[model samples]
Target: MAILIYTQNYDGKFKKSVFELVTYGAAVAKELGTEVTAVTTGKLDTETLKELGKYGAEKIITITNEELNDFSAQAYAYAIEQVAKKINADLIIFGNNPYGRAIAPRLSVKLNAGLAAGVTALPSSVSPFTVKKRVFSGKAFADVVIKSETKIITLNQNSYKVEENPVDISTEEFTAEIPEGAYAVKPIETVKSSGKMSVTDAEILVSGGRGLKGPENWGMIEEMAEILGAGTSCSRPVSDLDWRPHEEHVGQTGKVVAPNLYIAIGISGAIQHLAGVNGSKVMVVINTDPEAPFFEAADYGIIGDAFEVVPKLNEAFKKFKAEN
Candidate 1:
């Protein structure tokens, strides 16, 4: 049996999360004494598909069905099931993103596989297959075991580090017979964000909260993000006041993130907000109040006014980058 990874590409380019899955899956493949094969839906450039080779995928399978293009969860699940069965994949892997989250559960039920979502670590022991994952919105960790004959896992982003080991890759096209009425719901329209890093995809993020006082003063935060090449986000109160879009909000009630580095300016870290972003590798909190709860969760804390501290930090970052 082989290990199968579901690789996703948007606009012909793969996200960083895909490589994480490949890296994680490749390690599992080595443990199981098998080669890893990747299955993706959509037409991508040969070179772009070959990039998976660096992460240890030996074969790439492309599902070239036009009906599968629109991303109906049911249809995509059926397509992936066929590929997995055809290749006799015992271990199936996905990134814990919107696309993977939507389809992984469905695929699990379809395949009758025990599913472990938001997995954060490699299998501690592969004989019985135990994996570690975040629980309670990043507040705690739990070890999960998959008992089914076929196992499914959706890995959390930034959990696995990519290590390149290049090999010759081969690509094959498969046309799956999607059952009747799989694509029942069709999306009417899709709006794409341009030129800015999405919070979920960003490696670094600079976020603000009510501490900033007003949306008008967000320029300093934006300037800092620009200098650091980071994404911008907000706390729940800031979004509630419409200082920022709800899409930029991070908390228990908002989007969750696990960037490599997260800088919080003017945000008082409530348990809810910390629940969302505590997965970040490094966190820096900037607040004038020395006793703000945010300091408890931050790896580094700065006690100062954001307005005074942000600009200076931005200039320092610029100089550091210029000198390096």
Candidate 2:
């Protein structure tokens, strides 16, 4: 049996998280004394498919059905299930992103396998197959042991560092026979956002909250993000007040992110908000309130007004960038 990694791609291109998933799967494969295989859908060139090999994917499988181009969680899960059965994959891995969240559970049910979602690390014990995961919305951790013959896991974003383990790789194409019911909820139109970095894909983020005063004052936040080449985000209140788009909101009710650096400007840390961003590697909070809850969770805290602090910080960052 082999380890199978669902390496989801966008527009026929892989992202950093895909590499991280492959690396994590490779590590797990080594622990289990088996080879790792990566499976994806869509049309891609050989050079693009070979990238998974750098992270220890011994073989890559592509499902090239034209109808599979559009993402249907059920269809994708069914396709992956077929692949797992074909390869006799005992362990399946996925990045704990939207695609994984939607597909892993279905695949688990289809394969009659135990699933551990939001897994933070490799199995502490391969014999019993115990994995650690965040509990209580990032407040605590729990170790879950899967007793099933086949197991699946979704690795939390940024939980594992991407490591390279080069291996000679083979590529193959599979055509899945998707049933008519799989397209029951087909998407009619797809609108793509342009000119801005996606919050989920960004390594660094500059976020604002109600303390920024109003939407008119958001130029500074955008400027800071532009200077730092970071994505822009906002707190729930800011989005609720229409100061920013709901898509930019980062909280339990909004999109979850785990960037390398998350700069919170004028945001009062709430438990709901913290639950979403606490996975960030380094968090810096800037607020006037000394007792704001965010300060407690931040790696660096600044007690000051956003208007005064942000401009100076931006200037300093500009200088640092110019000199370097």
Candidate 3:
């Protein structure tokens, strides 16, 4: 039995989350007395694929079929299933992101494997294969065991730490049978961001909410994000009001994030909102109201107006970045 990790590439580069998954899968492989293999589909440079070795991937399988260029839930699942079967992977790992969400469940059903998504920790015990996972939109944690002979896990981003265990990785090309009508629905347009970190992959996140008053006042927040090299996000109300895109929204009804540092500006810590971000390693809440619930969950709190406080914070951050 081998541990197979499905690595994803966006705009020709592997995101940090992929390496984290590889590291976690490598640890699992070690415990099972097996090796980790990484499988990826897309057009990527050989050098980029070899980097998985540092994360303990012994071999990297590249599926270079043109049909696999763009993401299709059914097609991708079938392709990965083929590789999983060839390698006899008893344990499969995926990122708990949009791409993984689209394909993991399909692959799980195809392989008849018990699946555990949004996993936050490695298996506490391998014999029973119990793992901790987030429940109720990250508000709670539950330990689950997969009684199936094969298990598939979709890891929550930032939950696992990435460590380098460099090895000489071998690469080979593999082909899979693509089901008919798999790519029936093709994207009409694909807009890719240039040199911007996605909120999901960002280490530090600078999030704003209705407290900003208006979307026009986002300059300070954007400036602060630029200075800190962080990603920008918004509260649910901001998205509901169309002040920001829905993708930027983070809450119980939106994306769940666990960045290393999450800075909330003008956002009241509602239970729904808190449920999404409570997994953050460190949280800083800046709000005018001292009674804001965000402060209760924050490692640091600033009871002040965001308009005045944010500009000052941006200046301070700029100076600190320059001096340090």
Candidate 4:
């Protein structure tokens, strides 16, 4: 059994999913008594290649080039194809990030493999590999069995933990001729979040909804988030109204997050909204509506006006900090 992983080098840093994908791929390779190889191409320092070993990759087939700066769906698809062909890979895993979203479908078509996105668990069975993924916007789940000759799975971020310590992996540079084609779409702008902790990386997340009243009142939420060292997220409507960037929008139309603790203020737990945040380990719902659906999923619920409740909570947190 041959295994390969596709990873993106973001400003010389591997995306978080790189660890999960590599760890899973390495396990599959170990079970099959095969080599676990990582395939990545981008503008990255050579030192980053050696970092793959911690995730259990035996070798990294990397393409280091500055021309690979901007994303080219064609270039990425072509490069991964080369690695798949050379490695004779039976399985390929990606982090399921935005870039992976663009490449996985193309790779699946090119490799003639079964594709499953938003996967949470590792493969239950590899031979005729089957995967489990969220469906109906996480209202339910379905297990899919791929009988295809090759297997490709994209792991969702925050779904699996990367091994904290891994053996250092050796990397080998593999070059490929980039396919010649004009990109249909190129990104002219990338607006990143300015939060203290990105939602995915945050252990605590504080979010607000329509109850925020207006963007002018958002200061309370932001101040609390800053004190807690947590990330800030908004309801879908809040972002759609331009109060927040689309990336900070946490819902069916935006990012899905599962942090250690999720504190939603003034947010009514609509089914669509819950779909994105249901994975959180601990949920705290602070809503004026006692009948809000989010309470069912929350570990704690405070039915009160967010304006008053949040200020009191902030004062308590501050006093406790001062005492400690």
Q: Return the TM-score for each candidate structure.
A: 0.98, 0.97, 0.96, 0.91
**Candidate 3 clashing pairs?**
none
RMSD of 2: 1.2
Compared with the true structure, what per-residue lDDT tens digits does model 2 show for residues 160-234? Answer: 899999999999999988887897777899777765888888889999999999999988888889888899999
lDDT of 4 at 131: 84
The C-alpha RMSD of each candidate to the native structure, in angstroms, is 1.0, 1.2, 1.4, 2.4
Task: State the C-alpha lDDT per candidate.
Answer: 0.91, 0.91, 0.91, 0.81
Candidate 3: tens digits of C-alpha lDDT, residues 167-285: 89999899889978899878788876654677787889999999999999998988999999999989999999999878788888888889999999999999999988899999999
Top of the candidates by TM-score:
1
Q: Report the Cα lDDT for candidate 4.
A: 0.81
Task: Select the stronger candidate by TM-score from 3 and 4.
Answer: 3
Arrange candidates by TM-score, descending.
1, 2, 3, 4
Q: Candidate 1 residues 1-324, lDDT tens each? A: 689999998877887788888988989888889999999978888989989998889999999998887888899999999999999999899899888898899999999999999999999988798999999888799999899989999999889898887778999999999987987897999887665788888899999999999999999999888888899999999999998988899888998999999999999899999999999999999999999999998999999999899999999999998998
| Candidate 2, lDDT over the whole model | 0.91
